[model samples]
Target: MPASLSVETAAPLASAADRLRQIAASTVRPDLLGRIDAASRTLADATVRVVVVGQFKQGKSSLVNALVAADVCPVDDIVATAVPTEVRWGQQVSAALVTTLTEDARTIRTPIAPDQLRRLVTERSGAPGAIGTLHAEVTLPRAALAGGLVLVDTPGVGRGNARAATNLTLLPDADAIVMVSDATQELTDPELRFLQQAAALCGRVTFVLSKHDLQHQWRSIHDADREHLADADVDARIIPTSAFLHSVALRDQTPGSRERSGIDQLAAHLQGPVRADVVTQRQLAAAEEIVAVGRLLAMVAQSELDVLLDPASGGVVVHDLERAQKTAEQLTQRSARWQQTLADGVEELIADVDFDLRDRLRKVGREAERLIDSSDPGRSWEQIGAWLADSVTQAVSDNFVWAHERSLHLAGVVADHFSLDGRAALPELSLAGTDQALRAVGGLDFIGSGRLGIGKKLMIGLKGSYGGVLMFGLMTSLAGMALVNPLSLAAGLVVGTFAYRQDAQTRLDGRRAEAKAAVRRLIDEAIFQVGKEARDRSISSKRVLREHFVGVGESFKQSLAESVRLAKRGADMPKPERQLRVERLTADLAELRALCEQAASFSTAHASVALRSAS
Candidate 1:
């Protein structure tokens, strides 16, 4: 952060929480802000919302029924409980089943018995092609709520029933999904997508491979389940349970059999503050990221403002603001390329999977999954650095060219209108240089590579051709916004500012750090003119241009140092696709400069505001 843009001096740990508090007080973007606030508060309150998820008959309701020691959810042989029967501890004094709808709402306070529930909440269409469309909210006893953590029993997803189909919709709300994988069948793609989605929506998601005791050998199944968790990027705190084993214990109502069965143990673990803590953690993590960004932005802005006030500070502010704008432009452009990178990765993965490696013989009995998986799985850290550099290089180069061509004409128009070379230079003159520069940067930066990763995670391997063109097209809408008008470019960049949020658990820690750094970069760009930005300007320039230009050069140097640091960091990630993308970004940056120079050369004076951006 530049000296001019400096703001927050507080320690990092508590800052995010404070930022949230501040945001709560303000009404700006309250809807969006409130989501973060809710997430933050939920995290702080330490509440957990656990959902007992599985196929309809796979004992979902029965598990909740057994765990909560209540029959709140309608459970029967017909597999009814279709539209996500959420049995939670409601604020209402009495037990009630509230079904909120688009048009109206209804509540059933009477304890809904299994048989009666079947009649009231029958199957309906248009719900993932499931049987019912009613939202069932049941109230559980206080003990069951367990510190405000609600246990939702959703209709099993893989059962091909309408209930299971709706599982995707409800998965995001769950902190932990007890995936009661039928000890009988293999986990399907939908199940996998559910886990993937859960991981995306809620950072902390775990799975349960129920009916463990039903199998002859539990070790192999457990191992496979663990591996499955790894592939889906899910964290496994798996416990195998068999209601059948406990049936004997519960049948006689004997406490000993129940504890030995593990069902009681699993249920005990599920209904605790620990589960709520998981949900809270996810919310906190999101809040922390956003606050961190806001902090950096505020700090960077202060640094710029400081430079703006001190003429002695010279052009530092202008330099930094340009850099910040340029960097932002690059990020989005890199995001745009990620789709192709992912596609190429898929091709590479498929290629590798097709290979007949003989090394497996040295390590015998290796399964097909273990054999073909890439050594890097998803590109290694080293690969990431290389990828970024390549993308940046390419992006910079292209944008630079575009800028150079257009800048000459712009320079002629501005005609040194605000010449830095003279005392008569009108500081009041509003040159569009900064604004145009922002446009150049934002324009290319908006070409994001995010599509590929999103598709891989969300579309799964189920999507067919058309590039799933429709899905990609929706994302392309950002491009349209970037192209709208002058101010719209920056606004688009701000509004379209997206975090590449994914549920890849291991990568999450790293991804989070990257997001923070990205925010910092943006702030740095926004306040381009900083006293500290003159690191690159030849100190000897003092002889030629005096105070302002020299100071501008210094500020440019500071900004360059920061860019170099980012580039150096990018060196650690060496994936071919990322490397290619970074090169692309670099290219864009070069082109960006060329265009800016062109505009400068044409304008007899500074445009004052040059923005280069791609949304």
Candidate 2:
């Protein structure tokens, strides 16, 4: 996207497909051409989402605007982004507001004036059309976005903030992440932790230090930041930039200023590693499909050509293909090794994930009990309740992250037995949006003020002691003794003291019991809600793998059967006509082999070369 890096850097992917399409058209089978066209469309429509996240007022929006060289995202002095703003490619500058009445409701996209973005995206009360606003979106005709690179500007993140959780949700869908921080200081603990998380979720995380022009000591800060990253074990490239300079460069049309702004270099990384990686992945996937089709067609042509050249050997050729067809058929069976592995893996995952959730909750429950013991639940319930909620939320989040990752590992295991490439397109498991599942756990119903008060305790004590005094006084008077005797008076005093102690102890024990029960109930509900969510996601992933691998097996079986049919048909031809057919078959086989080689080349070597060249 920089002036130095030509737009032609993005052209290789399209060019490769064009060359392949020409060859595919020459093939006799209609399905071959259709497959290549569909792949090309998928590649063309693919968008690389680069999510930008950072602490509040770190110039995140400014970095986004500078990267695209457009005032798409609104910048502010005091307030920060409240909702995500997605800036992507369009023929003309346009903005839209995405809204929904509730989390589960369908989204509505309404067009808005470009200038209205600031009011909608920033923290503003009573702004028109701001109610139920989910996120803001803008599109421009900037060349930086021409290759389907989308820039997401997210709300600032802080420790334990829901905004941070929201940012985590974005990482699963992001192709790359840019973490913005100003050069006023080195990395903070929270920022380091966030970087580690972003790296795990999306490996293409780049650290960008904004406001470089304002910090005279930025180089020292950069050095310290690198060391902090090394100590934290977060892998990211740190780039320093001055968004102010970039804005000035654009206004003055000065390339030198733009280069000094460091925006150009950052843009190059996106255009190079970030955009190029997306292209490479799509290209490899398309190549895999092409090669598979080519191999099948070549098999049919080669078999038919064998029969045409040697008419007497037609029977043997058909027999060999029939044998191969049976082998392919076995792959489609329920008893296949891959199918068995998938079933076992899913079962193991369900049990393990449930246990993991319970273990995490058990630890949280113990910690809650400790807090309750340290202070009276009646007075400190507010603080304790907040702590409990945050702790449980964290445990649930960590458990889900583990489940999602394990599911991916299981998919790779199945791919080993199913695919010749020994790889799988990472299954699109719906791992994000756990807010609903988390809410399903409900809240604890512990009445912290449930214990008896002083007035009630006094009343209960009097009632019990009064009965004891009346019975003892009557007994003493029946013995012709005055009720005011020392024996009677002593007995009355002891009963009253005993009654008061018993009542107080009972109330205190009951409150503790009630609090413990509530804690247990909360933990149980969390286990049920989050555990069920994990299992559902696991089932969805299993179904995807089952459908994909079974389809591949079926294709193989069909191709082999077609090869057998072609061989038999060629054998029945007259000798004179067979001679003419052999020549055409031979040429087609050679062409198919050549195409397979080209596809293989694209799948393996071209991607890394593109990265290096773009750099």
Best by TM-score: 2
- For model 2, the local distance difference test gives 0.76
* TM-scores of the models, in the order given: 0.41, 0.76
Query: Which window of 10 residues has the lowest lDDT sum in candidate 2?
Result: 1-10
> Residues 1-615, candidate 1, lDDT per residue (tens digit)?
111111111122234445544533432334335434644554455455676665446667767666666555565666356556666665543333343331232332445444455455545322322111345566655565755667777765433232243444454455666667756555665566556555554455546666666677765777777777788777757776766557767678888767755776676566543453453344334433344334332333334334333435435544665576454343224242322333343344333322211122112213211321332223343333333323322222222222222322332323232122121111111111111122222211211222256556444423332233344445656677322344544333333322123223435444434443443353234223211111111121212222322232233334334333434334344466445645555444344334323322322211111121111
Summarize candidate 2's per-residue lDDT along 267-288 as a digit string, tens digits.
Answer: 8888786776666666667667
Kindly report which residue stretches of model 1 are placed more than 4 angstroms away from their true locations once superposed.
1-16, 19-39, 45-47, 91-116, 122-133, 158-163, 182-237, 244-253, 268-287, 290-297, 304-311, 314-615
The total of clashing pairs for model 1 equals: 168
Q: RMSD to the native, candidate 2?
A: 6.6
- Clashes per model (N, Cα, C within 3 A): 168, 0
lDDT, each prediction: 0.43, 0.76
- Shift of residue 259 alpha carbon in model 1, Å: 1.2
